[model samples]
Target chain A: TQLLEQSPQFLSIQEGENLTVYCNSSSVFSSLQWYRQEPGEGPVLLVTVVTGGEVKKLKRLTFQFGDARKDSSLHITAAQPGDTGLYLCAGPFTGGGNKLTFGTGTQLKVEL
Target chain B: DAGITQSPRHKVTETGTPVTLRCHQTENHRYMYWYRQDPGHGLRLIHYSYGVKDTDKGEVSDGYSVSRSKTEDFLLTLESATSSQTSVYFCAIRGIGDQPQHFGDGTRLSIL
Candidate 1:
């Protein structure tokens, strides 16, 4: 079975600080997606990267897919209290199925 | 929001009792999935349905069963609830094309 591991399981920082979260897996995937979930709410898709070394930006969040397609990262610039949440990375295996394996997750807390 | 709803946002029950969770979608997506989220395990797929009356077991389907009788509804059943099964459950839907899945708020189940 494929497993995705995320680094810095928990993070706390003051507002305006910058943070980066990483997701790694031994298995290569066809595509990778990033999501952010707030307390008491479901996760919302932030971006999907299909090609290796691809980068996508959504407002203050920047997502990068590794060149090997086995890892990905999310960077938040000038973090704010609104950016505090659980971030998860997920991807479908190379065989192209309707299923996706999700990363362990990184919880971020931005304080004022 | 892709029109997905999970019933009984929070449920508390005793061990050995039978439990059922319902997922309803208005998007008429062709795929629906059920996942359980734990502190360290991230989100593990429990079951998935490809179409009406067509379903498959996921990585963690030992104690869970799923049924899809309509295009917009999928039901997850726990034959005998166990304390280890206590976790937040999420329902997600995916369209036919190359689209990311959208999730519902989630159902929090506590088995005591």
Candidate 2:
């Protein structure tokens, strides 16, 4: 089974701080996706990275895929209280079906 | 916001009782998935359906079953509720091809 592991399971930071969350896997994936879930709500898709060493930016958030397609990272710059939520990374095995394996998740709390 | 909705946003029941959670989508997506979020486990896929009357189990499917009789609805059933099964459930839908999946608000189930 393909597994994605996220580091820094819990994070607490003050507003304007910067943080980076990492996701690693032993198996290679064809593509990787990042999601942010708020309390009492389901996860929302943040971005999908498919190329090795690719980087995508969404305002203050920057996402990068590993050079080997075995890892990914999300970096948030000038984090605000609204950035508090659970961050998850997911991917499908190279040849696996449509099913996606999700990471353990990183819970972030940005205080004012 | 991908036109997905989960019924019974909150449910409280006793052990050994049968529970069914419903997922409805208006996007007419070809794939629907059910997942449970726990403290340390993140979001684990319970079941997924690729088409009408076609479904498959995920990593954690021992006590769960799923049915997709129509393109817009996917149902998850817990044969016998257990305290360990209490968690927040989410439903997601993916359109054809490799598009990212969209999710619903989720259902909170408590098994006492």
Candidate 3:
């Protein structure tokens, strides 16, 4: 089973619309991160939430960490075509190394 | 962009052939990582290095090996490539403390 799972595997909406993607896991995490990947490029770190119940905002993007530190959500307001990409959430793969376990990505397409 | 460079952004190899992908970073980060991105699996860590000659296996390190001879270079090697190993590979680097990882453009590998 996947350590981290994301919902709404694929999302397509018109520009200016809003959308939210979720990442969940059964195991507790010390921290969770969000990444965005554009076509033909590697995933870029969007945000990281280290404290439970923490909420961070990056421009129009807001990231929230669950109170239990087992899940995360990324919400984008006024989505634009430039926001089209794959959204992924990750948690540190503890007990193994300093690696991370990423979720099944959510492919977001903001159409004009 | 983190000044990370992945060699041979694309490659195609035959089964049973040995292949190596290189990740070079100019940021002189202390930590480096190799990850593979698949269609539904998102990004899976293959290996990571904490410092020179200090490395550890990740969740999917069965057919992969890594080497960190210097602080700026990390190399991933597939002793005997298989079709199942074909995927886009990414390299990332992170500095000390609670810093986010910066990634390369990624290498699209195909094993025929």
Candidate 4:
């Protein structure tokens, strides 16, 4: 069973359009992270939310962690072709080890 | 990205052949991970190592094996490569248990 489930498996829109992707889970997490991956490359960490009801912004991208800590979201404002890629979410695990369980994944395509 | 590197960026091998993918890190991180990405399934954990000779299975460990004999190297091996095993594999590392992870470029493997 997938620990994290993502919505809108595939997304496509104009470069200037805005979009949001979600990650949901039934279990509580100590922390949650969002990553953006380009074709032929490994994913890069975009943001991490460790507190409930936390909101973080990186450039044009905004991330929100659910109050329950079981969900998260990534919103991209004025998307660009450069933002086209796969977005993934991973959850909080114990012991400080890199044992994060990841979500399904949302593939985004922003056209010019 | 960071100091991690995956060898044989791309490879095509026949079924039943043994294949190995290598992940090397120059920063001497204490934690390492391997994940496989598939459509809709996103990135699933396969195996991770907290230290040399200490490894554990992830959510998806079937048909795959991994080893970390040195602090700088982690290897994933397919005992009998199958078409079902074809996928882009990623390698990641975390400096400590609670730290965020860094990723390598990735390796594209195809079993024909």
Check candidate 3 and list the clashing pairs: none
How would you encode candidate 1's per-residue C-alpha lDDT over B1-112 as one tens digit per residue? 7899899999999999999999999998999999999997778999999899999988899999999999999999999999999999999999987988999999999999
DockQ of each: 0.88, 0.88, 0.86, 0.88
Candidate 4 ranges beyond 4 A from true positions: A94-97
What TM-score would candidate 2 get against the native?
A: 0.97
Docking class of 4: high
List fnat per candidate, in order. 0.78, 0.81, 0.92, 0.92
List RMSD in Å for every model shown.
0.8, 0.9, 1.4, 1.5
* Candidate number with the higher DockQ (1 or 3): 1
Of candidate 1 chain B, the 10-residue stretch with the lowest lDDT total is: B38-47
Each model's lDDT? 0.94, 0.93, 0.92, 0.90
- What fraction of the reference structure's interface contacts does model 2 contain? 0.81
State how far residue B16 of model 4 sits from its true place (Å): 0.7
Give the per-residue lDDT of model 2 (tens digit) for B21-52: 99999998999999999997889999999999
Q: Predictions ranked by lDDT, top down? A: 1, 2, 3, 4
Q: If ranked by TM-score, best first, what sequence of candidates would result?
A: 1, 2, 3, 4
Q: Could you give the CAPRI-style class of model 2?
A: high
Model 2 Cα lDDT, one tens digit per residue, A1-112 = 8889999899999999999999999999889999999999899989999999999999999999999999999999999999999999999855666888899999999999
